[model samples]
Target: MAMAVGVVAAPLGLSVISLVNRLQDIFSRVGSHSSIDLPQVAVVGSQSNGKSSVLEALVGRDFLPRGNDICTRRSLVLQLVQIKPSQDEFGEFLHLPGRKFHDFS
Candidate 1:
């Protein structure tokens, strides 16, 4: 499904993230068995170094679990898209398509 999102033009033109997001949408629509490799961003650092905190700040949400110890044991792929200010912000999971998660907490 195509989402009605707001597009912010970059100062110098289209950014790499915009291109990758477009490519990802195309590949996802094609199917799961497509053998195309898309560029990805990996957050690697020492343990308890605020990796999850950085991601949460970027997405402007506090959905990721945080504590004094390690809370995430599995890899997570997050797709962030810009939305219109008038529209309510929400999140969707690749495994559970069509369901809009309004609450991040």
Candidate 2:
């Protein structure tokens, strides 16, 4: 039944989440000072192809600039972290270390 499947999937999902958190911690400690080559995803398409829109939707935030004109001129590195519900949500930039951006806008 659906309930049995849900019980099995819940633990598997939690295990995956735990693994991701561990990997992120390891990368954070090792890659902060040195150049660590990590996996990347490139979204290539024609102009006005809704690429930015899709990324914003995936992140559940309207952080990307939107207008009729050209918005993004340089390459962007976006890092998304999953946090606990009790923890405060924020964003950080590699250039500006130790500063937490509470507002995405």
- Who wins the TM-score comparison? 1
lDDT of 1 at 36: 68
Best by lDDT: 1
Put down candidate 1 lDDT per residue, 1-105, tens digits, no spaces: 564579655643236667777778777787665566776667878888888888888777898877777898677888777666899988787779899888756
Error of 1 at 105 (Å): 2.1
**Model 2 per-residue lDDT tens digits across residues 1-105:** 447544544466566656655565677667754364444567778888988887888779888777798897667767676678998888776668899877756
TM-score of every candidate: 0.61, 0.55
lDDT for position 69 in model 1: 76
Which regions in candidate 1 have their CA more than 4 angstroms from the true location?
Answer: 1-18, 28-39, 67-70
- Model 2 bad stretches (over 4 Å): 1-39
> Per-residue error at 27 for model 1, in Å?
3.8
